[model samples]
Target: MKPLVVLVGATASGKTGLSVELAQRLDGEVINGDSMQLYRGMDIGTAKITADETQGVPHHLFDILEVTEEASVVQYQALARQTIAAIRERGKTPILVGGSGLYLRAATDVIEFPPTDPGLRAQIEAELESEGTAVLREQLREADPESAAVIKDARRLVRALEVVRLTGRTFTSFLPQRNHLPSLEPVLQLGMKIERSLLHERIADRVHQMHSTGLLEEVRRLDAAGLRKGRTASAAIGYQQFLRVIDGVLTEEQAVEETIIATRKFARRQETWFRADARITWLDTACEQLIDQALEAVRG
Candidate 1:
């Protein structure tokens, strides 16, 4: 089987344009690895590539879910693997592209998720609601200190607790190792590297462009479609801020500023995650011959 080309980067670091060009050059089909891009009607906020921007390349896994649905990494892994196999069977290369670290890892790495019990999960969620996240955090701390130290979100806390209770094992035990999945197709991992200052500027500019392109209106449409009811969708950076604007808790200007700040922070986190993986070949985005360098790296 041909190796998979995994193009990963921070948001607004030029992954989309480069991936499209690479796909055209390599005769590859682009697969969506970004978690948010899976939802329909989230185009503007998620910075989804336009049909024209796809440049005649076939893309998979974009806009596959409704706003009300929650996305699971387990489900995504299955779907992405299936897509990759089909693409390769057709004799086309599969280019996996996105900024979503866990999603990308799930699609390419050897990882197994623990089983979920709805009853146990519901019980844990009730405890979270009644006693609050602090209680759950303390519980996780006692049970799985590693997960406790890093997981701050209520949902994740609940999940860690649930796993610990169900399997009597640490949540971290299920984490993907720094190696590829057995029997899976090999992958050439590429990362985009940019100067911090320039990346921040690019993030701010992208946020501004998202606003000008009617991100608020897109949020409004999704909100009307029950976005707030969706745990994952409502918590997205731009959508969360704009939802506040819709509720009159924040001005449009304030929402844009918040989105910019949030995006910069998210980009930083993305950099931290991707940089830790030494297997990835980091290409400076400033290089004019970036695509050539990437092709060379792959060929070599």
Candidate 2:
């Protein structure tokens, strides 16, 4: 069993700052669990940490890939496991921190996801590219209405359909067996939470700051790299909105407003997802004794 500390929360909930503080106190290294933070040159829109902000603490999995390359959850899990093992072998704690629930869940679940069918996957992807998402979505809506509701994106929907078409089982039926790393050294999982109003305000401010700091320019660079707006990475909340703005589908001001709204919706989904997790130990952001309480948890 590995001794791990996980910090999970929604965007703009102050995960990075608190994780850094906790790592300094605990003598730990941070392994990023955020998806957007993995891509190189996608700094401002993703609110990626600067070298100055890290303040000499080593971080993993930031700026590792180009926007043209796709890093899947399976790949992330493998890298995270290797990183965690190295950290533990050196007798330091491994602090896993970020807002990506899927990535975090993939790392911690300790389950082998159903093996993907490469040929079928390629065919499905081709259909997605040629037929467009709406048409493929309609196809899924007919075959697997339940899955269609959840996998709304064309790429995801097509993949789900592929699994079902090949195996004759609902994509949900092939769920990997649920397993967890043995809990030792009291794996402290802290979730930062704040009021809706305050969180929304913070998200809006962060969006404005990204705009001021050249998020549009970053998106243009990704576009230049041949990654278009509708690609999986580009579908990310902030980046996609700006891509629309760049394409003349939206105004700059409209993009800002839509980005903020989309981010708020994502935060709500995150809150809902984590709320159901029995493992999480929630901490109110407004509590005056937050650090003390968190420290106490980690100590215990």
Identify the runs in model 1 with alpha carbons over 4 angstroms from their true place.
179-183
Q: Which lDDT value does model 2 have at 49?
A: 86
C-alpha lDDT values of all predictions: 0.92, 0.81
lDDT of 1 at 115: 82
Candidate with top TM-score is: 1
lDDT of 2 by residue, 1-300 (tens): 445889998899988987788778878899999998998888888888899998788899898877877768888988987888898887778889988887887766655455678899889889888888888777777777777788855667877888777877777765543334444243668899789899999999999998888888888888888656326578778888988988999988899899999999999988887776778888888888777767777877
Model 1 poorest ten-residue lDDT run: 176-185
Query: Model 2 scores what on Cα lDDT?
Result: 0.81
> In model 1, how large is the Cα lDDT of residue 244?
98
Report the Cα lDDT for candidate 1: 0.92
